[model samples]
Target: MPRRHTPGHLPNDRLTELRSSVRERLGAPRPQSVHEHTPDSTHEQTTYSAQKQTHDSVRGPRTAVVIGRLLGLTFVLCFATGIWSHYLQDPLPWMRFPTRPAVLYQVTQGVHVAAGLASVPLLLAKLWTVYPRLFTWPPITSAIHALERGLTGVLVASSLLELTIGVMNIYHWYAWPFSFRTVHYALAWVIVGSLLAHIAFQLPTIRQHWRSRPSPRRGDAAVDVSEVDTGPAPIDRVQTDHVPADSVPADHVRTAGSDRRAFLASVAAASVAVVGFTAGQSTRFLSAFNLFGPRRYGDGPQGLPVNRTAAAADVLTTAADPAWTLEVRGNGIVHGFSRSELEAMDQSTEDIPIACVEGWSTSARWTGVRVRDVLTRSGIDPHSRLRVTSLQTRGGYAVSEMGPEFAADELTLIALGLNGEPLDLDHGYPARIIAPGRPGVLQTKWISTIEVIG
Candidate 1:
């Protein structure tokens, strides 16, 4: 025989009987007390234990919420960090750091790439946990929702395509003709704008949900109560009530089966993507360490083979400070760094690729003081745009202004080495510059003077 209940609350005797029945079924000790409480201040705490099972079923487990929260937090952090890594520079003055071989650049770049790859898994997990709500037609009533969706679509498409091409490029798989950086940069704005809007709309929802849930302690599972549909009781209680299928609705059975199949399909797809992405790639995505050392491809003029150019005048500066001065002689922008004084700042090295807008990338190992450190030593604010004068070039390279954060980008380096040896003359031997994810034109070679302008 099955137990049944009406809409009305159980009588006092029936409540007591229920408790006894539960204790016997579980072979557990009876509660210290068992009785229905009047709806009063005194009764709230008293009735808590008696209604534990019923309340638990209605509210769901604490573990479910914790898992959701962890997934959400991880995805959010990865997304923010990934975007910031691409856009923002590390704030540390690179010129002040010790100059090492370009191997350091390779390791850091690999980490950056790997973290990006891992985002696929993290993003999918987050979406899965929240996908049920997508069926609610329009999620938000305001125009903000439409704008957010638009931006998000653009960002998603851009980021995925950019990453895909980048991975292929690293492995020498060249099938795309478009300039990766140009396309990637243009799409980045869409993603960033959409991300900001998404965060804005979710702020209120996040706060409301946080307050309603109990503070999750360390090691305690986060419970997700937001998805609990208590609007109406489920008809087929196969899982909920352990009821036989004969008494359940056909729709209930169908829905449960569909959800199961969908979950399985999603898992299978994720496995395939991870495997397919790594196949035949020079650098394996699954490995924590990269076999390829730090070195950029095509640091010089693209399409042209490796060669040397003779400038009208040699502008190479040396450590010999007997008569060295950085002549900041352009547009009233005063900035100077003696060879000795420039050497006094911290040095850094990065093995970054010199990517050119002309459709090519080259690898090289750079060793020099950090440009940021040099600017700081010269008392120049990093926020100002810089005009770098090269000895081999007649004109200056007009680099845009970057906030202090850009100087901190570990990839930015004032290089002094090539291929494990001192810089060759043909290359920017005396001193050069290297910055990650930036076009080669910005990396002025044979650096003679750096002028700071507003």
Candidate 2:
């Protein structure tokens, strides 16, 4: 049976007032507080939650853009220098490299190695900033998006592998079974191609996020508020209509901008430091800064670093034998000269730098007969292409070719003396070919023969 009370009368139950009093005193749930009931307060709470979720889910666009730009610039520099190095090693007839400015290879190779090492940090940061995208729900928005993702994966894997192999090569560590040169060369192309595709796909997003500015808050007059009928929102989806104007404090926004600026500065400083440290190995002026570099300028035997000693090349016995004679052959004619006889000939001196593939170089005054003079003395054509062979019975670079341009260059020498002293046994003693703008490996040491092929 229910009790009915007259208008303006209290509850007929004697316990009603006591229950109400107790609930109020204990802070029990009520209809709503004045603040919570307002639209502004509801919007503020929603905006704050959405913002927090957004930050946790992905890095801001500004951070990604800054890191991406730095990585891209480094990649371009590395690729250009890498191509130059490859071409220098395996030359084609269509292209001719210069014989002047002997330290060109030194500078280029140093930059290549330095830029590569610096890119490691930049690449890691970039990947971390955008890592959330790798797990995007639905995975693909369209066929193009799928292709972009595939290319992105390729870019990441190849870049990391390339850097690993490159660093290993620098230290002369070969853990992998495959040929480093062949694989590295092939992967360079793959990386560049995939990088281009990635840029094409993300250029729009990159542009949109290049500048740092506050995004529009939710529930603004310009935005339409609507509810979705879907069962649940995707992790990547942000509800833009529920953000209040004051959800993000002005101080937080300024701090974020400052943090981004500081991060970019830190990355730039790190890159510069890396380059300075490694480039010092080749750049004499910067040698003081190469605290972590493997080799320093003006180091090794005869003030020039030796990649392989005579013993390592298996030329120790042959190179030191008194019976050693350099044979010059051309057009069915062969002329042999002993070390003494070679030294007796009219000598010319030229200052040339020995630039090695390992990115170290040193300049010295080399004294000997020019390749052209030697060919002429042997009754061979001065402009003919020549093959220079070493006393090294076994080695990949035991023999090297001298193009017509190199053969005719006045500075190309069958060097018998370095820095006005007799060539040291470890420095290609007796006689070695020294040419301008050539890698140290190609400057065949302990020379036994030179033949004109064309």
Candidate 3:
């Protein structure tokens, strides 16, 4: 109202003077038109708001470091236990698994499953703590940077998939078309490899930000004044300010350190709960606490949990048939044993636990003829490697191998009874292999044939 301002009609000297004055007042290096300033100003406001929001809510590097360390430790334990289980199931020629510790498999597999389950919460917490990094402004700055992000993505995906399928496998669920064992085994290596690469890439950043420190706040003297004058600053130096007492309730305030500690504590509590809920399946003493566990101790036939029942294996009719005979073949010699004939032979009793790969185990008094005795009776060398075949025509574990050491173990038996009763059809019926320190799957059920390969 005081004076009318002309646009293009202004003198060049006047326009230059005006631009200089405006630049001086705003601390900008250059003058912009109203149209140019409007969009730029709006964009800067939006960016500042977003940065402020991120600074206030996103977890600091300290939180990521702590959670990441915990996650790494848990993953290491899970990986070691998982490798042991895999080797026990499919051992290499040079590897010899111990047979003395009767409960070794039970304990190891139990720890494996429990550790894997507990890692679920830990992994989620770690991912959440570092989630803001996914939105890093310059997503790709160079080839190495692009490779680092790609590896991180692979690590996340593979870890999640491996854990998902492992839990599903414990529940006896197969939803994927690919072989669960093969894929799960292979993805474990990928997860570990990617994790190593990710750690290498982030090691410097992790070391720099591992310790918590007092951060500057908005309007604080510690903040760079030049940044404030510039309007929108990079998020790296952004700080959250405390609300004024008159503007917001004091009780609503939360310190960053306290929030980080609370989040970590919650994750720890979740892991504990998960382990407590699932570890009971293997530790019989703690079974009552495992309400969420897949299998209960004594929930199946003859006080033993059955992972695959006769009906599920489609062997009910075949296994229950009166003419069913166990065929034992060795070096050009074949011998068949009828149920009565096998029972009429010397029956010995030994307490053996059926430790399954699914992480459930139950100890029972098993009565049967010694495997060595059967091999001797059949005129076969008990020292030779043997293959035990199940009556079930279908399933991945229909046939399992017995190393010479396992076959020669005196405790190994073609069990005919459990807990002083005739074996339930679901409990491998007439005869099933029960070897000390062997996986339940390797203790082949519904024995239809035993072929000595060497």
Candidate 4:
């Protein structure tokens, strides 16, 4: 019934049919291979299903948002207080600091240093949670993305330098070549600007994860939203369709959640620990608990921690000179007072905390002539601004500016005694400025002259 076929050859009609079938198959439009992708970047055709899985437990947008919020809060606090401190230190011609609180600078500076230290942990955690973005796929997907990444780089670099130098400054370490104040202040602006820009770029993602969204079947090998940057996450996901190599399988979903929780707990604990140890330096009662603080609040000459010893300032010889006298100079008026004369004038004692820029502080009983009384004796306006000079010949703080409120404050004193004892040779023996509501640096030590200024 069927035509007989040769072993190695087919009939002419059969061969023609076979050739035609092959030609049709070759000419038909071919389906794209799973490994192929176009330049438009609609989908990422990955050969390996696994993507990067580092820190998967804590590597998500949610963690980033939480840590970012905390880091942002501290940065805000640090920025606010830091600005206050800078203004106080370098007041503009029209600026005048308040005098009522008396310990305003103390509190503000303490907050500044405390926030700075607290940021250490928050910053580290934030970096850890978001570092994966550094290796995001299609690393330079577009020019806008490239610029966004550049912004992120600036934000991170400036933030690290800021926190690093801030911590160094608190310890009174000047290992850098640049002026800490100048660089620190400038970096603050950079950080704030970059931070704001970053937030604007990330608004969609931040809002998306501002509150938790429903999880997608737990561990369904989902793409990490945090890696999506500040872009519209839904759209980014559609385009990228990335699944991190480290994503847990559905069976391990609970384990992933547990790991994330553990990571968060660890970060919180670290922050608490850092605050516990360093914040105590500003709290007098917590002095015993402070370990890493550069100065102990209770341990120094005359029971006050002294950052710069009279010896270190090279004022030891000049301070002890018997002729050392505090001179009050004003418009056509000059009055000088020996240590005995200062103690002889009406003495005022104020138990106030003297806080250093470094953040350590101590409550001391300073008894000496009221600054207003001296200004009045010198026939000068008690509220006149002053140029206070220290006996130390060499030092940036050898001379300091004084606001009128300090001269007018009844509690402001040129102290010759501390804690019921005469000033120690190391404690500005002849006399030292002790003003309220100001930084200790302005409490110019080893006083030599006070001149009234416009």
Candidate 5:
């Protein structure tokens, strides 16, 4: 007959026999109950099986819930920062930068981009934790699920498109129509709407889990090994070998169809978000590529100088030709100059921002003859108005008139090389206007004329 432990009453021989039997049944690294025994008595032992199951069962979702909350908080922060950067009416309280419109615009734009990038890793880990739930297709689903799916679809499409185009603009890739600007602007509101809806849907679950908190700390509790074994059972069948709590499968029970569907949805949403987030900034890298490749400025008519219309195709010429002429007409003054004569004047270089109406900006080194030099050479007063023309006859040539002081600002120049080398055809190769603090359209390309007036 098998003997059972009865605490203080068991004899030494019985205790020894029980210990041996328990070890054999439950395997080594044996469960020990730290019951105090008199110096004359055998040591007491308790099983660990019950304690182990209780630990695993209670801690599994608690860990997941904690991580989910952290990730959700991070997501909220990312979105909040982006919106604040874009639309907040006032500067952050402690920020030192003065609230000039252009300065604020650039600073907020940079902050928005930085925050967006940071979201990638955070959202990825969150998705990993939540993805398992997507596989479960819930029974008795309501209209809410349908609504969630629709919102998710919109978020995915809008996010991908916005990220792609926004990145392109930042890098100055103009292959696509600027119409993307209008579309992206409208879709931003839609994205905000969906994000709000998502948060609302999750609020109940978030609050419920927060209210019912569980301990995250792991304790060194002894397991109840006896629960695993019936009398005379082999150790392997009775109990599992010790494994790390973290490695244990989260869901021992089979997942329902609804649960599986939920897991899949989470995965799909996360995958799209991370992919779009990462690929969206390729254009930034591309923009920086041109910075070191060539120098773009040179001696020429500067400011809004007009020139004869060349064949639009020839506007995309490579290697400067001696035939280049600048047309300047303003204040009843019309004059033309050979490329060599303009080059003979005092030349200088400037690093200036080329801002486009489409909302991109680039800094390039512009080496060129000053607008003052061209005006002085033509016997035209710097105070005279100017109109610049382009070789492309279809679009009316860009026009801007400025007084002597603004025209002669050191930041303004007519550029020949883009970064460090001569301009590439795609970027107005042979002499283009590059004025600082002005829209890109105001900078005429394919220089054929600069018409100036007194």
Candidate 6:
């Protein structure tokens, strides 16, 4: 029977009776002291068993589980690779990214972008499969149920916004008033937390439908049952549920599994299509497959891609001024050199991949004076951390900090040439900072100053 409610606080006899009833039902002691203040907290559990027995739901638990697993994998991959990219662009104290593995950021960021792209189809499919459950009767069955829905809401909304931010960012679109990096980073955590909570609430459902059962015999109402025994409340457990004959979705009402199979296949194909073509920007071998990639891997001036041009940066005239000189400053010393003088300095050429946060990359032979040589000339320790400031007079990417590992690495340079010729203005002409394993944005094109720091 449903637990009865009365006016004011629960009476002592009713409270004691409720505790005993629960203890007997579970055959275990449920500590009631934690909710003693509320007095009627446990009363909500009344009729839960009876209600669950008659609960009607939309079928597709198996579909939901399968889509969920794939969606969750993309989320995890995107989050992990996102943190790695974030650390590279904005490392916390005591964090030092390696200078070797010159293409590490390229690979991780590529995976991150690809995972985000793949998630779109998977997310839509998962939402479609489970959307009907949002209308469950008696929505707030218990405190935990309320929590479960709240978490799911947050996960869905935040995930949508996060994906939007990522797609927009790749194209350098920032229509939002908020800082994209700050908001995107914060939302990542929120989405991940909500996802974990939602997963916890749905663990039982997931376990129940983790694998599909045999197709029901023709003419016996179609069902998407699991091989495992789910408890009393499953929508697919057809014989026990008292669902109305007309309430089931049409797809679930079909006798054969053709509809469900076709649906899953379509969603999978969409995911593959979205990821396969776009990933060519990052996957060199798949370059021929690139259809909508924002930038081709090897299709810009001087055989390299460019995110920001001199005109966009408002540095066209300034970058071209021959009077311009690269200054190295530290302590009480300042050493400056014109482009030709710096070019005349002992230069080393090496193949380095200029990788972008947008997931595009191309390797090029860069020739320039090593950073440590410039630092030493400024009377600073060759191993000291330094700041590379660009000729651009605006924006965050114009100035970037170099860690000691990169400053000391022989490959870190004030590049003066690309592909055996002077750099194009779009490719950071005169000179630009280029280091191994760094994001392209942080390469600080159109060099102006390098300052040593602690």
Candidate number with greatest TM-score: 4
lDDT of 2 by residue, 1-454 (tens): 0111211211111112222233445666432321234323233222322222223323444577788888988889889988988887777866677887776776777777888888987887778666655655446656776788899999999999998988788777889999888898899999999999988877755764566533454342122112211112222223333334353344444554576677677877877787778777777888888887778787876777777788888988899999999999999989999988888888999988887766667778899989898888899888888889999876678898888888998989999998879888878888999998877878999999999877
* lDDT tens readout by residue for model 5, 370-446: 77667666777765445566555454434444434435555456566565666555456567777654445556666
* Residue 114, candidate 2: alpha-carbon lDDT: 83
Off by over 4 Å in 2: 1-53, 56-58, 211-247
**Which 10-residue window of candidate 5 scores lowest in summed lDDT?**
40-49
**Which ranges of candidate 1 are over 4 A from the true structure?**
1-79, 82-111, 120-162, 165-386, 390-420, 425-427, 434-443
Residue pairs in candidate 2 whose N, alpha carbon or C atoms collide under 3 angstroms: 218-243
The predicted structure with the larger TM-score, 2 or 5, is: 2
Candidate 5 TM-score over all chains jointly: 0.42
Query: TM-score per candidate, in order?
Result: 0.40, 0.80, 0.78, 0.81, 0.42, 0.79
In candidate 6, what are the lDDT values of residues 136-189, reduced to their tens digit? 544566677788888889899989988888888888788888988888889999
Name the top lDDT candidate.
3
Candidate 5, number of clashes:
70
Clash statistics: count for each candidate: 29, 1, 0, 4, 70, 0
lDDT digits (tens) for residues 350-402 of candidate 4: 87678887777877899888888999998998988999999887666788888
TM-score, cand. 6 vs. native:
0.79
Candidate 2 vs 4: which has more TM-score: 4
In TM-score terms, candidate 2 sits at 0.80
Candidate 1 weakest ten by summed lDDT? 230-239
Model 4 weakest 10-residue run by lDDT: 45-54
- Name the TM-score of candidate 1: 0.40
